[model samples]
Target: MENLESENTPNPRNPKKPKVVIVMGATGAGKSKLAIDLASYFPIEIINADSMQVYKGLDVLTNKVPLEEQKGVPHHLMGIISPNVEFTSKDFRDSAIQIIDDIISRNRLPVIVGGTNYYIQALVSPFLFDDLIEEMDDCCLKESIGDKELEYKFASGNDNCNVDYQRLKEIDPDAANRIHPNDFRKINQYLGLYARSGLLPSKLFQGQKWGRTDNFKYDCCFVCVDASLHVLDHYVEERVDCMINAGLLHEVYDIYSLNADYTRGLRQAIGVREFEDFLGFYLDKDYNADTERIILSTEDKMSKENLKALLESDNIPHKDLLMESINRLKANTKRLVRRQKRMLNRLQALFGWDLHYVDSTESLLGNSYDSWPRQVVEPSVDLIRSFLHEDNCTVPTKIPNAVASQILDKRDLWTQHVCEPCGNRILRGAYEWEQHKKGRGHRKRMLSLKKSKQYLVDKEAEAVT
Candidate 1:
């Protein structure tokens, strides 16, 4: 793609930099172990790419790497935000890029490891929010009033708030086909941009060049952890059990007390949601007992005793109830495994990665024929090392200290110049400005504003020719 060079670089060889290695896989796929093993041999820092793990106080629930497990190796992007705060992919991309540059400056290999596919894609893809937002902004301001009317005016002129798939089809047929019709968020993002910018988000991203042309960038290999259906089911069951033993119920209870929004976010989490149900049932039993005791008359002693005796007798069937609970847990675990498998398949297809099925093994070193450690783990590490050393492999171009220092200084200068509204580094082009205004959140904000009288007046003035 496009390469931005430092002015002081007289020779391309012997560049002052190291490669970035990314380790990606599904949840519970042993990514952390592989990352640690690779970091042991190289001057590497692990950057957490998981979305949920970035939040604080979710160490056990999110499976964040413990401080001791870091093995004195630096880890970035973990526990940086409170659980109450919502994090978006753009926020992740900005932080990750800054950290990656810092790591390279220190001559350390940046190894990004996580299961969050969107965050990883944001890092590797040529599409940057800075440019996209700029393009969207310009488009949003320049569109003809007539054009906006044609786009926004549905057959019934009902404002078309749900997103128009047909508009997306006109702009990017491929994207329209890939995105489900019911996926309102993505659909709205594309359609809303098209209505304002007259350009599709997918089309804006197609074939765009990236400044970082490091061979290591494209040379990065993806190794997906695969397992048989039965094995995966068993693995999920064991994992859920471990989570419960780790006090997942208590974690959910703690989160529930924070706020409705916090509870909603936790409920949306995988294992946390199931555990919340368990907690809800437990609380409901206590609530029912309290309600009964409050409503029952103390003078009706015989009736109250009969009711208490009935409940006590019913509660005696503990073993049967425990068996039922176990069965339900097993079933839920199976469902979760199936969902994970589907998500893995979808991400694998999108990224075109090499999937390696690793059999369960006790040790990292075992029989090459049967174990994940021997067959998948070691081979991946070998590939990373080979890519880093190969002469033809694209290492980031080296720059002289003077030129590199100048570029770093320029970056800092522009840091404060970044858009305060979108919180991204400002783009140089008008086209990019237009794209940002049409992005999902911006458009959603605009629509929300249109409902208010004061905002309506401002919007009207802005729309005036």
Candidate 2:
């Protein structure tokens, strides 16, 4: 570890916090490109913040920047974790912090870039509520639940384990009301927090200064490379198409198994789940000797068209399923783009983090290859340069809005609501609750309940007469 005192020293204005640059955006939004381009201006190392990219395998599915494309710049924490292990946000935060420290130690700028906002959130915020949940999973839960017993019950779903949830409800109904009964992790965490500290987690942890800007560990220059949804949606679809052309199926095929858990590890990526139906059908032994020969013949190529033709000639239903699976992959990737954008907005609006937005819509729509440097990279570089120089001229100071600051505290974002009229469907947050109220199903249920009440009243009066 090469130690460099120059860049590691605290800024004169804010002596406590060191500078770190974070590049964030939606999927297929050129966040990696922008971050890599920054290396020309400043000595920097890139840390992968995207959750999927951290896991090994499925490089095409995760869209990791290839070694040649990385332009000889050092990138850390990408494709290092085992494909089967569940790497939590705390895992990312801890690893990234160590990498960032090393980068700063060497006098290189630490440029953390990815679409995973929670990973970034966990990195920036010193004491996130999610950290408590992670802590419980690590240290606290073992003491409260008994380590080996917890492992057994968590894996087997023992009926007697409801004792922990019931205990949580008894101690803190407010916390218990928010978490679902089956969510053993949170149930145990809340119980662990209460038992360990003798304090209600609902009151103590619900809405602390977790994601606030002032409470962040470092002075961060947040750069979001964003574009219009229409452009991003089109780009995401195109990228998925390109990934398919680039042996994405082959990557997925190598990892496919009959008993593979889709909810865990790299299998949870969008591309993997969408192809389960097709893979299950293709891999089934009952498909006959001819189908098996066709499958074995195309093992090397694994071309989508080749698979489609085999399915079409043998079974038309299987062919349609394959096509639908490919379409689903594209659709799911687009949905991920939208979701990542929404989270970025939430971080800015709710958390009061000063995010410098560089709109790439125009460049993406026009001559992207030529204009990308000007529209996205150059503007992001300027913001970061100003940030490094401690110039407030280009950067706006974050003014914590009192109402917005307290909103999470006053109303827990994780607070759950169950609508009994709507078949006991659970909804989280005020926004989701309001949306459920306006939904047709909820309205119909309420109307039926009202009519039933009126009919019962009429029947009772007739009986009395």
Candidate 3:
């Protein structure tokens, strides 16, 4: 590996904490722009930590930095996996470690960049995720649930897993009792493990990586880029507009069609699975490829003729369906922003050592938002370089605002978010969150917020002093 001295050094004998750099933030906090710019000035090659961008295609929706913008810097692990395949956190950690070590050996700074926070944690803190979750199917049960049915049950997200919980209790009561009836996700895993491996997740991991062994195989500094919430929402809205203008709907349709109703692994990408309603609208019905094209065109803002045809053919207004997709995309993204903020909080709580934050709100709200300036990238790059040259304290547990952390924690009502601006409106989910932002009351509050210049404290950052 390169002889670059990292700020946070582990035990000399530990091979885990290799020197590396990381850039992370919410959905539209300019992580890509800053990363590419840093690469321009330093000997850095970006190794993607984003789960969605690792898949091929859907560049616009994923908000991938374009080649022309990269300015000839090499980026690894981006758009390489097939969207049809399941790419887990483990897949990323394995692939990225190999790529990072390779870059270091080439005398280049290996920079891990993306919104996927878990991947970053896995890199710097070994077994960052719960060790019980198996990376691949290890259980060998005689009778297993079919994939489609399993997917349906999981996706349904109801509290109907009580029976499975009961069955699991008889077989593996420890694991079953640990999971809640409503948490089908955990229940399914517990039941599935016992059915296949005749053991609980904890028991199955007899010798595998589990618990804190201090074996993180890389040394890294996480650059958390952020903006005020009001500022971020505007940026997100602008990106959504750019996505729409850049044929986002068509991209979703193309990938959705290509996957042909088998939306696995990559379906979690922001916009893909959100199109469930539109896709399900035609699931049982069949149409030729050409007819499918005409129907899809109706959703395109540019397809005037298709719009006319849609109005004439279906009793429901084409505008309504298209708006449904648009509304969904927007709301889901806002919730993503919220969730990402929470992830940042968790990171702050767990590994506060040598973690630096770059708040570029004023710059992002500058006369030109997309135009990169020194303010955005220089400080972060300098900090990273400093990490290479200086000795920094190991990650600490001194949480900034423990009290605020408790208050800011989200209490979702069946995956919901509450917006205080609009009649204390309860946003049922992402679609409602996005639409609420654009609604009269929310926009009115946004303008008020901008005028007041009362920057919304990053809800998650409340964990910090």
Q: Which predicted model would earn the best lDDT?
A: 2
- For residues 1-465, what per-residue lDDT tens digits would candidate 1 score against the true structure? 111123112245755333467776555667787878766567778899887888877566677878898888888988887666667667788888899878766667778888776777667665664546557557635456546635554422334533466666666765675555555546665655556566656556444533223312333445455456665566656775676566554565556421133233324455444433433433333223443422323453232123223323554443344334445656765765555555554333323333333333333223354466565566766666555665332323224335543443332111112344454545332323454575676677666655686877888999994
How many Å off is the CA of 420 in candidate 3?
A: 17
Model 1 CA RMSD to the hidden true structure, in angstroms = 17.9
* Consecutive 10-residue window with the lowest summed lDDT within model 2: 291-300
Q: Give the CA lDDT, 0 to 100, for residue 204 in model 2.
A: 85
Evaluated against the true structure, the overall lDDT of model 3 is 0.64
TM-score of 1: 0.60
Predicted candidate 2 versus true structure: per-residue lDDT over 1-465, tens digit per residue: 223256456557856566888999888778998988888888889999988999999999899999999998899999999999988888898888898888876778899999989899889888865566556656754576565545544533445547777766887887887887767667766665665445688788555777888898987888988899889888877887788778787887777765566757899888888888787777643334554432344444444446535534766767777778889998988878867876775676566777888888877787657678888878887787777765342755343467556754454455788899887887776756775698777899899999999999999999999
lDDT at residue 123 of model 3 (Cα atoms): 64
TM of each candidate vs. truth = 0.60, 0.77, 0.66
Q: State the RMSD for candidate 2.
A: 6.8
Clashes of each: 20, 0, 14
